[model samples]
Target: MAVLQVEKVSKWYGKHCALNEVSLEVPEKGIFGLLGPNGAGKTSLIRIINQITGPDSGRIFFRGEPLKPEHVNHIGYLPEERGLYRKMKVGEQCLYLARLKGLSSADAKARLKEWFERFEIGSWWDKKVEELSKGMAQKVQFITTVLHQPGFIILDEPFSGFDPINTNLIRKEIIRLKDEGASIMLSTHNMASVEEICSHIALINQSKVMLDGEIKEVRSRFKESIFELSFKGQMLSFTNALGTQFELLQHSSDADLRLARVKIKQGLTVNDLLQRAIPHVQIESVSEYIPSMNDIFIKVVEQPEEQMV
Candidate 1:
């Protein structure tokens, strides 16, 4: 079941259309990457989902039912712009937010203890938010965001201010939450993170969805029939062997290792290229060059609207 569904949702501010018939689904227990360039309506859509703002037209459903104010309790949102009472104690702040989500004071305290321990921030309980570093404070906010164990979580730039270790830690926690049956909507410009943790993605551009699908399927859709070849033999021999069966788009060499990117002609297979090249060059590896999410994002966002498929 989809944890959240947006159907032909449109939102306008003055004369500016923020979301134009934007529609997408956040699958249950999976991480959905919400991708788009800055000011591309990503924030607008997120706002509507969180009910911070309402759509001007269309509808939103939460688990097959019309979204209502009560549905807010089932959602946990960590926006890109993090906020916390700077003078408040870390544990106190977390407990307060937990209760706001409908948890009783006792339940909230118990849950906060477990989460604080799990995050190894038990010692930070008494520290003021202002006393902590940006990353430290971020960790506190993250714990509170998921403390209530909401079924659906929306995280925007969740890894911001995190170092490599902290980033990986959060990434693992995200996957763990999904494994435990929580659905997540991850919004960020960090394509590497999206590629690593997202099961599906929806790309928004110019107030519209330019692309949406499973991660692998989306990447596959942008493939150019190009392959990367790494060999230890002469580049000239490799090129000569390929002949017209493949077009060598670019090549480079480092030490004895030579790498070349080639696009196979129509009807020609990888086996066909290997069959011809085997006699001339010692093949180390050959793999298809799949475009990364970053590449696809730039391509989709920059391409003329009419040219998109």
Candidate 2:
């Protein structure tokens, strides 16, 4: 079941439309990537989901019920811009935030301690928020946001201030949260991270959803039947064996093996290409080239609005 459903939601600021009929569904227990470049209206859609702002048009449903203000307790949001009382002690501030989320004081303390230790930042509990570096401060904010263990999470640029190690640490925790049955909507420009954790994704451009689907399905649809073949043979014989069913796009030699990228002809399959080449060349490996999310994002965004899906 989808935990959150947005139907033709739109928002605007006076003469400028920030979002135009954006619709998407976040599933119950997996990470869904809200992908778009800067100024693509990602922030607008996220605000509507969090109830921080209302859509000028369209509706949102949370687990089949109409979205309401009180449902904020059911979600944990880590905004792109981090905010915490500068002079507040990390531990004290975390406890306050957790209690605000409806946790008992005792439960909040226990959860905060567990997370602090796990993240190895327990020593900073009594330290002032301003004393910590940007990355450390982000860690505290992250802890407080997730301490309540909400059923759904909205993380906007969650990896921004972290170094590589912390980035990986947060990535692992995101996966753990999903495994524990929390639905996550991750908004970021890091295509590598999206490919790592996102089960599904929706690409937005100019306030419209350009594409949306399971990651594998989207990649397959964008793939143009290109395959990278690794084999050892005379280059001429290999090209001649291809006949007219395939076009050799590019080829290069790495040591003794020759690697070539070939596009299959219409009405032909990888097996057909193999059948033609196996007799003339020694086939070592054959793998279909699937476009990455970054590739798809670039290609899709470059197309005219009328051509987008």
Candidate 3:
């Protein structure tokens, strides 16, 4: 089931088009990655979803109903740009934001206490927001964002200022939230994080969605049918036997081992390539080279015209 849907959404700033006919569906209880390079209109689309701005053309839906002011209560948004009152104490600020999200005073306090304890920041509650480091301040903002238990959450560059340890901490919390039935949309340039945490993704470029699907399906769509083969053998005989069935993209040799990256030609399988080479070389291991998310990101963004063609 989809928790949020953007249908033919378009947004403009003055005469510049920020988003053009953008559309995507975020399913419930899954992490959806909104991926793109800088100035790709991702932020514009996010702002529209948050109701921070209106779309020039198109509509949005929340849980199958038209998005409205009341639906804001069902959303917890942590924008890329951090916003918190510098003079306000951590606990007080959190409580204030929680109430704004429709939580009662008593309930807000109870939830704040629990989150503070879980985050090991109980002592920092009384500290002013300005006195805390960026990461600590981010923790406070994160706690307040989720304190009301909103059904949908949008995190833009959530790992920006954290160290590896804290980054992992938040990543685990995101997975936990999904498990407990919260749908999340993660917007970031970090392909590693997307690969590790996202179940589905939509890649946007030039103010339009270039690709969108489950992670595995999208990855499979970009595969190049290349394989890495490690073996101990004579390179010439091996290359000779395989002939044109497989194109050796790269070849290197050491004292006793030979490593070659081969691309399987059309109508040729790994088994067929192996059959031709088995009589000449000792095969140690063979594995396909599946493109990583980072590789795919660079490839897609670098060839926008080719993708459209």
**Top-TM-score candidate index:** 1
Q: Over 4 Å off in model 1, which ranges? A: 241-245
Clashes of each: 0, 0, 0
- The digit string of per-residue lDDT tens for model 2 on 1-309 reads 899999999899999999999999998999999999899999989898888899999999999999998788889999997789999998999999988888999999999889989999989989998898998998888888799999999999999989999999999999999999999999999999999899999999999888998999999999899999999988789999998789999999988899999999889999999999999999899998998998998998888787765
Per-candidate TM-scores read 0.95, 0.94, 0.94
Clashing pairs in 1: none
Rank candidates by lDDT, best first.
1, 2, 3
Compared with the true structure, what per-residue lDDT tens digits does model 1 show for residues 1-309?
888899999999999999999999988999999999999999999889889999999899999999999988889999988789999998889888988888899999998888888888889999899999988988888888898999999999999999999998899889999999999999999999899999999999989999998999999999988999999889998898888779999999989999999998999888998898889988999999999999999999999999998
Q: Which tens-of-lDDT digit does each residue in 35-103 have in candidate 3? A: 999999999999999999999999999999999998888999999998799999888999889999999
> Which 10 consecutive positions of candidate 2 have the poorest summed lDDT?
300-309
- Poorly placed runs, candidate 2 (over 4 Å): 240-245
User: What does each candidate score in C-alpha RMSD?
Assistant: 1.5, 1.7, 1.8
